[model samples]
Target chain A: MEQRLGLEASIAIAEVVCRCDVDIVAAYPITPQTHVVEHLSELVADGELDAAFVPVESEHSAMSVCCGTAAVGARTFTSTAAQGLALMHEILFIASALRLPIVMAVANRSLSGPISIWNDHSDVMTERDVGWVQIFAENAQEAADLTIWSFRLAEDRRVSLPVMVNFDGFILTHTIEPMLMPDKEMVQAFLPPWEPLLKLDVDEPISMGPVGIPDIYTETKQVQQHLLTQAYGPIVETLNEFAQHFKRTYKPIETYRSDDAEVLLCTMGALSETAMEVVDRRRKQGQKVGLVRIRLWRPFPFEDLYRAVGNVPVLGVMDRAISFGGPVGPVASEIKAAFYHREQRPKIVEFIAGLGGRDVPLSDFGRMFDSLYTTGETGKIPAPTIIGLRE
Target chain B: MATQSAKPKWTELAVGTAITVPGSARQNRTGDWRSSRPIWNHEECIRCGVCVIFCPEGCIHFDQDQPGYPSADLEYCKGCGICAHECPTACITTQEEEE
Candidate 1:
């Protein structure tokens, strides 16, 4: 049975993690990500969840503990935001290289220089090559659902890789929304007990993450690269299976009314909801506009993206983070590279918006669509624009 | 001398490059790397077992036939000269290998 409850996204994600029956929850508390581990600790302390709750000193130690537990065949989880995510950068690569199935929730927040603790993709964008399967959630419901799906995806034998679930800080983390909370029995049916492909055991000793000398270093990296690339199939299969069991469909690239659209606006995370609303207004005004939201950040979902934007003359890509003097925003840069060789591709208009927790109002999205319309007519790509910039 | 002849292909490597075998260090004979070899003058040697204790490889032991006299097992010794350097009775000396 499913129970509908109004819950904070962070708390809902924690509840989903508890239902997954994770063996270990090792984490350090950071803002926006604090509520998740805090609730999880209460669950463990109250005997509602039987798991080891390691209160690590720092985010680096948290990820280190996750790696240790996951290596010993324990289902492990952790959560962090912004600077905390940045601190775990070193271990992030090691966890995936060693093929530890550790699931993490990153409440997306802006990185510091001027020191802002607001929602943005800067933290995750900097970790693009860390080799973990990254996914973004639009709202509370998707955040909870993806947290559950992340465990299944990570523990899949065919795709034994770590997963990071990203949801906007404060926007999703602090907001309370109605979500269908699946009971323990349903979660058990969807995700079976984690059966590790390899583990650290004294009885049958095996060395994991052995020193790859020059003779074998390249070969080991080649294997890891191939495994991550091939993991796309398993990810899609897992999502399809989840849809069948839960009766809720999710795609790597989700489209809204884009079939006859002349200009499609693309975005990720909670901003997509606002973009969708803007698209509706434009459609009402007889403008052929649509929305494309990226759910999967890694493995790039090249095929799904091409199919979603098929023949759409203009694509307004809204990025939450800048690439620091690069030709376009990080998300837009990837999109441009993906379409570089293709003969039929959209004229992508890059946009950097909602930086350092700045609000991206409906008017801003309206402006993006207008620019897309102009680009569609002129067929000329303009310089990247920063939405809502004061000066 | 036990070095593997053919390395496994990338496809054939174990997941995460985990080594499934235990105590594989014994299979690698490091003696071939020796640039010099240790020789013992058993006549002046005390059976204090100091050389046996100081040999970095733990390759020095009392000669089976000559009882208390310590000798280096050339099979695994890298001729580090640790035993010669640590010999209290000055009974051990290192000589450069001909080859």
Candidate 2:
């Protein structure tokens, strides 16, 4: 049975992890991400969850421990934030390369220098090429649901890659929202015990993560790349299976009132909810504006994004992270590249907003929509605008 | 001995490129990288088995023909000169490879 309860998103996510029957929870405590591991430790300590709670000295060790445990066929998990995620950088690549299906919840936060402990996509953007299956959640409910889904998607035989569930630090992690909490039985039925395709066993005596010499290194990378790219099909199939079992539909790219519109605003994470409200307000004022929220960030849903945009002439892409000297923001750059070869594509206006825990109020979204409407008329894509930047 | 076989295609590689076969490291002949070979003077050799113990690759062993004299298995010896340096009797010497 499922019961609705007002729960902090981090705690909710921890509960979902418990229901998944994770074998090991190895993590270091970082702000925003701290509560998640904290609650998980409590669950293990209080005897509510039967699992090994490894209190690692650092985030790097946390991920390294997950790799070892998962290699031995243990359903492993971990969580971290900005600097912590960065600390786990090198191991993140090894986890994916070794095909360890470890599940991680990243409380998306900004990187340092003029140091900040606030929410942003900077942390995740830094590891964009780490080869993990990354996804974003729009709210607490989605965060909790996606955490469970991540484990399923990652452990699939055809897609044995680690999965990172990204939800804004503080904003989504600390906020309390009413969500239908599914019982252990429900989650068990939806996600069966992980059946690893290969594991480290003394009886079988197989070696993992061996050295690839020059002759075989390229072939090894080619195989890994092929597996990652082809994981798209398995991701969709797993999501579909979850939807059928849980009665909650989730798509790679979710659209709100974008079936027929002249302009659309693209966003990810919790900001998409605010964007949805802005779309509603704009529609009431007789403007054909809608919203496009990307749920999948890696093995990016290029086809779904194209199908969602349809013939919309203008698109306002909101990014929470800057790509420095390169193309304004990482998300916008990807969107541009996805449509580069197309004969017909939307004129994308990139907007960098809500960085470093800065508030992205409804009015900020209103300004983006207004700028998008102007771009629709002028047909000139302006420079990437930094929202609420006083300078 | 490590033999070089034709590399497997990307499609033929196992999942995660895991070497499913245990002890596959033996297939890589490390001696190919050696620039010098070790020459043992059996006359001064003490048969203390010091060279056999000091060889990094453990390629040195008591010769079957000589009963106790140590000989290097050139196939796997990396010519690291550890045996020459560690030989207490100074019986082992290193010679530069010509080919």
Per-residue C-alpha lDDT of model 1 across residues A353-391, encoded as one tens digit per residue:
999999999999999999998998887888999998879
Write the residue-wise lDDT of candidate 2 on A123-207 in tens digits: 9999998889999998888898999999999988989999999999999899999998999999999888889989999999888
Worst 10 residues of 2 chain B by lDDT: B1-10
Specify the highest-TM-score model's number.
2
- Among these predictions, the greatest DockQ belongs to 2
Calculate the i-RMS of every candidate, to one decimal place. 3.7, 3.5
Poorly placed runs, candidate 2 (over 4 Å): B1-5, B64-68
Please report how far candidate 1 places residue A296 from its true position, in Å.
1.0
Stretches > 4 Å off in candidate 1: A325-328, B1-6, B29-51, B61-99
Return the TM-score for each candidate structure.
0.92, 0.96
Candidate 2 local distance difference test against the native: 0.90
| C-alpha RMSD values across all candidates | 2.8, 1.9
